[model samples]
Target chain A: MRLLLTSATSEFGRTVADLLSGDHEMVLTDQTRHAEGHPDVVACDLGDDDSTDRLVAGIDAIVHIGHGGHFSSASDLLDVNTRCTYNLLTAVRNAGINRVVNLSTLRLLDDYPEHLTVTENWRPTPGVEPVILSAHLNEYVCREFGREGGIKIANLRLGFPLVAGNTAAAAASGESAALAGDDLLTAINAALTADLGVNAQSTDAPHPVSFRTVHVQSPFENGRFLLKGAASILGLWEGQGVA
Target chain B: MKILILGGNGMLGPWVVDALGDRHQLRITDIGEPPETTHEWRQIDVSSLDDVVDAAEGMDAIINLSVLRPHRKIAFDVNTRGNYNMMVAAVTHNIQRVINTGPHYQLAGPSYEDWDFDLNPDMPPQPGTRLYAHTKALGQEIDRVFTTKHDVYLQTLLFYHLYDPGDIGNGPGGSGVESLGKDMMTPYSIAWPDAGEAIRCAVELPLERLPSRAETYMVFADVPHSKFNNSKARGQLGWQPRYHLESLWNKR
Candidate 1:
């Protein structure tokens, strides 16, 4: 499939680009304007109409791994995450691109200090604290796009991305190395090839909505996938009947 | 057998009634008569422990889907006191399952800046704001106590938004209809369906296999950016959701 991979300059994006390049035609872009080794890079600012328009034309699928800092002001955060996503999806629909892989953070699920292993069915209790609530808003936008567009949307939430060989500092800094590029590649590959029907809705055969949310995390070697991103990849793979 | 539902007229109670109604003996009680169909109806204030006990007697399963009224005192009364009363009644009555509605806040808390970790069902309840959320947290705590002390199966479902095409015009009161649609379908809202599936699993799964504290499930489509997890529900309980937000909303 022809792919548009955003955030190509980020560490994880670079890894995914390298992994997928051998088998797929990849078009990479980022707000940074310059990606070191990628020659087909484009400067697409999600905030700009022209940039969104350019990215949406002719791409079969989008790996929207783009994100900015969380703003203290709720409105600013919404503008950046929620509205920015809205612009992209609208552009994608207009351009007739129906498949997307939305890269989301696990923080959207963190509602308390007691630690919760959230499932896709949990709904944000309105009036939540701003930061987490804003993230939830971003998640909501993605699903809405899928519902309205009938686009095949895959949301992969990563915990702290593990930078290879950065264990000591990574641990002390509380950064997760789990969401690294290679880790994402596993999920991306599975999504690319997997059937979504099985994972798209319950096996009980309910009619699917325009959207689906699959957890992608590293699977436990025992054949169980946990770690957000791996689970989604496996579920997508299982849904698709891909080996 | 005999099933009792607190706030039986609310969002999920009606569905639970439909799913289990024909199979088991069902009795429903709520403060107001909910619009849907059900087997039996009794008027009861869930906030009052006395009323809860009276209604809970002679039921196999007690499903509570009432939203705590926003008044701090009332919210506290119904959510905290009323929840405790329901737990005690279940224990006393030997109800097979106690399914209470839980929201996303049970897993997602105030400390997070953005998505990072998939909600782990094994994680303990987190800190939250709002009297309603506070009460829900308390209900989970009470459930934990009952789960251990009485061997009663206590399940809390952190439900997602239930939207109908008809609701789009008026929206959810304060929010505009268009914005409500935009907000409800987001990736973070994925847990909406898992809430129902969690309830289903709670009733279907054997008590011996349930988690010690509480469990959460996601019930929406597989969106790429979501932070919830459904591994335990799928792997442990072998359960899955039967509906997605759009289908659920549009179908009925």
Candidate 2:
């Protein structure tokens, strides 16, 4: 598939592009202008509708990994994060792209009572925190698009995507919310290829919303967010050597 | 101060109107006719930008109490778009303060049956599958955006279940199946009077003293194995609930 990987300059976007390069044709983009010699990367700002439309025109699918950094002012984050995502979705619809992968955060489940196995179905505690609420609105954007039909969205609610060697230390520091790079790659790949079977009559079958939120956390014994539907939906547990 | 209470005709709206009416100049607006009240009442639909902007003119602050049933179209209209309209109107009119009412579904699991632990205001919102919760969560985001950009003070008070024990066996009773546990609900439910007090505190608290321009508080009476931590309301807003689940049983 020809894939559009947004925010390719960010750590997560770059890593995902590199990992998926072997199997899929990749188109990389970010808000920053691309270097002159790198013809393979497309310089696009998702906040601009025309730029987003041009970038998504020929792609078969999209991996939306862009976000305003942690230091952005609250208003800036809200505008850039939401407008960019909304713009991308609108362009995706106009461009006739059928599948999209939105990167949501595990922080949405951050306020749940500890030790209770958190599921995708848990309601997020509402608040005014800019980044977290932005993530929430992003999911709503995906849902709105999904409701419009002809689009399939997989929202991966990821934990801290840490470097391979640093995972142990981060986990040990009582923050059991870090995801290994390999796990993140596997989860995305599964999301890209999974047969959602939206028409199945069983209650467990994926709903017709065509938009699903799956928790993607490394299987830590004491992790705060539970990876309930990730294994069955994304096949993240298939060969990870974890249960 | 002139306070505009949007959705002031709903279930909890009357109680809030009663609580704050004498202390402040009150103006109530709702799509339906304003319930019998001496305060200035206007029939306005919050989803209409024109209506909200007109009603918001010269108001000191807005107390948004409007909510819609979980039906998809109406929920999106009244909760999501209505909030956007109100925020824009508030900013346009230079109204600096807005208090939004949201539900505790943000903390509750998929349903009341799946609830497990106490949630604090600092936690992220999880609206799950309910349309009402999802729209209300989106409205809270509108609050954040407007507060950040327009320098408005926005506070969202997320209420759990609100009910009077006296109404339990009288009319059309509570919804839910028989297998549902009372224990799961008792901790999260709030008496109507206590819920009113929380709203009053949110409206009257001095904004300059608040820790942040945007804030959220969980308002509920003290219940056993409660799923919400009310310390922020207590320490920040100086709010305390005089009722509890035991108060309902004790009345017998």
Error at B146, model 2, angstroms: 1.8
Model 2 residue runs over 4 Å out of place are A1-99, A102-138, A141-191, A194-243, B107-116, B165-181, B247-252
User: What's the C-alpha lDDT at position B6 in model 2?
Assistant: 92
| Candidate 1 per-residue C-alpha lDDT over A1-243 given as tens digits, one digit per residue, 9 for 90 to 100 | 789887677766776678788768898886643454556687676653566887778778888763323233533443445446666777787788767877765554444332344545654332233454445545556765664445777776554544343223333444422333444576677665544444344657755444556654333222112343344434433332111
DockQ of each model vs. true complex: 0.01, 0.08
The residue pairs found clashing in candidate 2 are A123-B126, A124-B125, A124-B126, A124-B127, A125-B124, A125-B125, A125-B126, A126-B125, B118-B227
Query: CA lDDT of B179 in candidate 2?
Result: 22
lDDT of 2 by residue, A1-243 (tens): 899887676656667778789889998876654323456678776743477788888898898863323335444454445556666877887888889988778777777676677788887553445666666677776766664466788988887745463345546655567777666777788888775436456576556547788887776666667665786677655333223
lDDT of 1 by residue, B40-119 (tens): 77888876667877888878778777766456445545665466678777877777688777666654554331445676
Judging by TM-score against the true structure, name the best candidate. 2
- What tens digits encode model 2's per-residue C-alpha lDDT throughout B1-252? 899889999999999987898899999999997699999999998877789999999999999999997455566567766777788788888998899988877434353326545678777655654557766877776777667557789888888688764454211343323323566566567768778888888888998987888998878776556456878877787888865556432333
True contacts kept of 1: 0.00
lDDT scores for all predictions? 0.58, 0.72
